[model samples]
Target: MSVQPTSAPTWHRLSPRMLAIHPIIELGRALPALVGVFFAGHAGGHGLLTSLAVAVAVVAVSITRWFTTRLRITDEQVQLRHGLLRRRTVATRRDRIRTVDVTAHLLHRVLGLSRVVVGTGTSDRKNESRIVLDGLTAVGAESLRRELLHRTPVAMTNQGSEPADELARLERSWIALAPFTLSGVVTGLLVWGFAWRVEGESGVDLLHSGPLRAVGHGLDAAPTALAVVVVGAAILVFVTVTSVIGYVLAFWNFRLVRHDGGAVQVTRGLLTTRATTIERRRLVGIELSRPLLLRAVGGARTLSIATGLRVGRGAEKGGEVLLPPAPVDRARAAAARVLNGATALTVDLVSHGLRARRRRYVRALSGGAVLVTAAGVGWQTGGSLWPVPVAVVLLATSVPLAADRAAALGHAHVDGALVTRSGSLIRRRVVLADHAVIGWTLHASLFQRRAGLSTLTATTAAGRQGYRVLDVETPVAIALADAVTPELLSQFRRRPAPAPRATMR
Candidate 1:
């Protein structure tokens, strides 16, 4: 809704243009049901009328959103009253507002309208602390975004002294890294799900169809290695193409800006554009991560460790992403710029030493040994030599994996931040501010104790809650805890016993 400042707060309705956009959105959501009705009606030769009736009913329900929804912004709170059958009144104190997001889907953009989502920084999974108002004019949305986010914190930290507003923008060359991202896998799963739904609704076994059966027969007739190679190559090509397309569609004109009012803004997306503003005071740290595939190509991605945003399974949730899969150096530079320095990300991390390296090998080899033993048992019973060779190959592969895992393990404290890096499959280098550490935990398993190693975890309310420095020397772990939170750890620390008096000797 387009809210204007008045002498006193008053309820406002959503833009009239929403009447056009909501029905289309609702029809899209009802597509599965509509398709089911169409198939059933077609069998009875009444498809057209039945489908039309369902679509009309969905439109009618969608149109009611405009009539029933009302929003109001007062001096102390923002209120949204929505729903028809079951009324809901959501309110949030103005002081608790941590973020202001303005978004416009394809339909809304065509009508020059946007959606405003005000977040209160609550960690509730249900998102009950969020207030959403859709169907505001483009200008009105920008005005509201400024109005909500202009109130600077009482104690502002220095984000940067740079006078320029723009921080970074999408580069065309960076699109090459898109193919290395997992977007293709997500797209493949979504497509598979839709096809599965269609098969169930149509009562057809797609895998047993004539074309698929012929392809399966061909694959079976070919040599196993050749068939595997051919299928893997095809899947790789398909995934790469889809990933590139998805990247472009989502981040065509991406831009990041540091506003003068102590906030940073990210604006991106092609079909559904979004503008997200996060106050600088809420940003606790930044995370730089690289999936195995992307790391192999020297690419990385980054996310802002902010209080209001939740880090979900996806790469970019609530606009937490600072950069998408790009060159590792570029990612680091962007992260450094955002944090107003390059010290933490560039500092040398302390190695966990040979014991940690040996532990990684032991863990990796143990896992591989289990597979080898299982394969041996299967060979003894089924008299199949194929399993033995596969297991042997996996066991051999674990050697390099163990080495990589060892290489990825490191941690350091630099520039008022705790920097830690770990994992080989998806290596993450997190630079968490020292002030953000609320507590410390030290743990060691029997094997770790024997090796004089402990895992030190820094507990914080931001990001993932706890960041671990794995398999370091026990003494070093305790020292790190004391460094981060001296008072908190002093009480729990184990003090050394005094030496026996020399007089006794």
Candidate 2:
């Protein structure tokens, strides 16, 4: 909804990035508008001067429309104003702001710009977005963030260099790669090889259906085996190239910026890059994942808290990613910062049966597959020692060790929070507001009920980190929730108590 200014309309700077995005506003519609103007001018064909005037009028209007649009960034609030005929100004204050994000495209790089989005509201923080500044340089965006944070008071910390009420920082970790792309390549190559092998088999020609009917019959339908081979090779090459590019783009230049206060900011991207903020208090949990191939490379998976956060409505998407791809130690340390727990101690939470089945066997299987494939390739090409298979085998050997390390990454009693680790391969460290939970829930599947495994879910006032918990005894999960609900509410009280300087051992 467009906000009505209370006192006065204050003008704000137009970040270069935001101005560049001005063109996007007229996207798709610009062509039609131009077409309409051309026809109207012809319809009103009169003296040469009148025709020239009409042309000039259209050009002037378009430029004015682009230039007149403005965004107002004030200490108290942010406002967006645009449109020649119908304009809107949406404003939200700082206290209500829950999430802030920076995103840039390749175009942004050339233009030296990025977009800032802030979101408000906890329950549905994802939807309440404001582009406080669509395009701003790195420095301007930071200054604007400080301005908004200063004018808008958050309960987490006051705008000062005072000792924090609770000292915490967010760290970043990433989920390992997805296996589909690689598997897809393997599938394509296998199919092509099969097609090549069977292109002239005795029964293969007999079973020809679509190709035979579409063209003619027999050899008439088939434009030589060479054409078939070339086409298949082209398609496979295209698919493989696109897949590789997508992977590189997805994880290009990933970085983590740790904050002194319990927060961390991460930025990564290839074409359209993204910047995310991980606030310690907003994180409810963490998740880890590893594909079969990634297991061979000793990589891990991670995903966490994007729940309950009513990012109090400001601009853009507010929640930080609970997922990323990172190594085990880094993931643990990141989680430590978020939980305000010790990085020194680690714990083991993996069930013995599941650990072997999920973590160990998979690693072995992936290693064996790569070794077999590499050996076959080595034989075909007359290899000198097949170094590829050796690497694969050794890398696979590290999977269990990484899982053991991440599992050892402990979650324990901190002064004001609960921290936990999940993932055998990709480790995710999660932090929860020990005293900020407003509701608690227990979830159990039929299998869980049978095995006495259930999960606990907790919700907080902020929109993010308001969702599910993992495996626990059903009854225990329920009791844990019930016991903690009242205790949490009471402990946080009207406001959070001062944060301890260091967690106790």
Candidate 3:
């Protein structure tokens, strides 16, 4: 149904694709509860009674979510109303809008559905971001985006190229690595391993009754240990495998088409799928990744962090990986194609100063220690003395490994792209907007003062700005920011036009 052209507030209907997403969401959320009910019924011999209750509840909840959810855009504002019982109605003026985004999960792929989300930066309320819109087909999302962008009044004249996705290859490889059955087993173990002590005692009692009564049976039994540990490991393996499988699901029928409107549309997915439309100028940064494992196969993942995403449910999770597990050349080509040389990039690891030398190894060592120690403790508490220490040692080994993975950052403007490398072991290549920077700052700490090192901070309208330091002369830091400062100032420059009155959307 079309949105009624009206001045008065009216409840509008969201796309059916939005409703269709409820079933998948419900299934994902209710899987644990479902398994519990099944085992509970068999163990407690309740037959169909308890099981039926769970089924009915699940169906009821899913149906309610699918049917009752609604969103509306009027002359003045956009409003999202959802929930059956404690209903939530979020309203915002059209003027507060900053960005809009669309994404499609692998599941959404099979159904030809894409999620469309809108983002705004104002915290007129609490720490909440602007409302997010979920579940729209590719075309509707495109139309909506164009309309919103046209009405939003950004610097349409200065718009550059559309943003690109980072980690697209890594995300794809992760999917290809998915072992669904194995992953499920791991999930079962993590969720049910704790339940086994209560398993023989009865699964039904735990669900209907909140208190869990621990039963001490044979702790040394191979089956019990195998059920939890071996099965859990297998589950992890499966998850990894499924991550690989995700590539197929997510990129199935993949196509990246350029529309005449200076935008890009990426359509891919297997079951209940999705498509996304990206306008050129909305991109803020491009992220590139070459994971340690993927490095062996020469894989590179790329994505973009655009004004597209906000922090909230639906589509506001910013920055989606554009190229999942593609060949390095292909991934780079795809990124370059989408960015058209204007994609934003971030510099995570610093190289121009002692910042890398001082904190890199220390942070890596501590991080490795904490991770390893936690794993070791978990293993030790499991009453297994062998795996606990083993886990700790393995984790401990990662400190130097991480350091090795990192690279030093030295940024230089190369053909409109700021390219730099940093991180100890995980070598990161930061490709960012060199000239689009909105602000810059230089600071020196007490230690930095002694070392004659000063940090250079570059600000953008994205989530945050980039911070880098140079250990060279104090003049160098200021010089480093000299090129950036003017750009930032120019972005904020005010025109001599007459002051205009602001009106509600």
Which pairs of residues have clashing backbones in candidate 1?
none
How far is 283's C-alpha from truth in model 2 (Å)? 4.6
Off by over 4 Å in 1: 5-9, 122-125, 152-164, 205-229, 490-505
Q: 283, model 3: CA deviation in Å?
A: 0.7
lDDT of 3 at 25: 77
TM-score of each: 0.90, 0.53, 0.63
Error of 3 at 105 (Å): 7.0
Residues 377-487 of candidate 3 have per-residue lDDT tens digits of: 777677556756676776677655655643444665555545555443344565656555656667777766866766666655553345344343466656555554555
TM-score of 1: 0.90
Worst-scoring 10-residue span by lDDT in model 3: 310-319
Scored by lDDT, model 3 comes in at 0.56
Go through the candidates in order and give each one's C-alpha lDDT: 0.83, 0.51, 0.56
Q: Evaluated with lDDT, which candidate comes out highest?
A: 1
Q: What tens digits encode model 2's per-residue C-alpha lDDT throughout 1-505?
A: 1122234566644553444444554442343444444444554664345535654555566555445667664446667776677776677775666556667777776777766777555545445455555656655554444334333223223234322332222232232233332534645675575554444321234235675454345435566886677668866676666545554565566665555554455566778787665454455544444444555555544444443333433111224433343455555555555544643225443332342234334555676677767776886798766666676766676666555643433333344444444454344444555566777666676756656666666776543445444555455455556455656546544686888898689
How do the residues 145-232 of candidate 1 rate in per-residue lDDT, one tens digit apiece? 7767775321232222323378888999989998889788788888899878877776667787889888888999999999999899
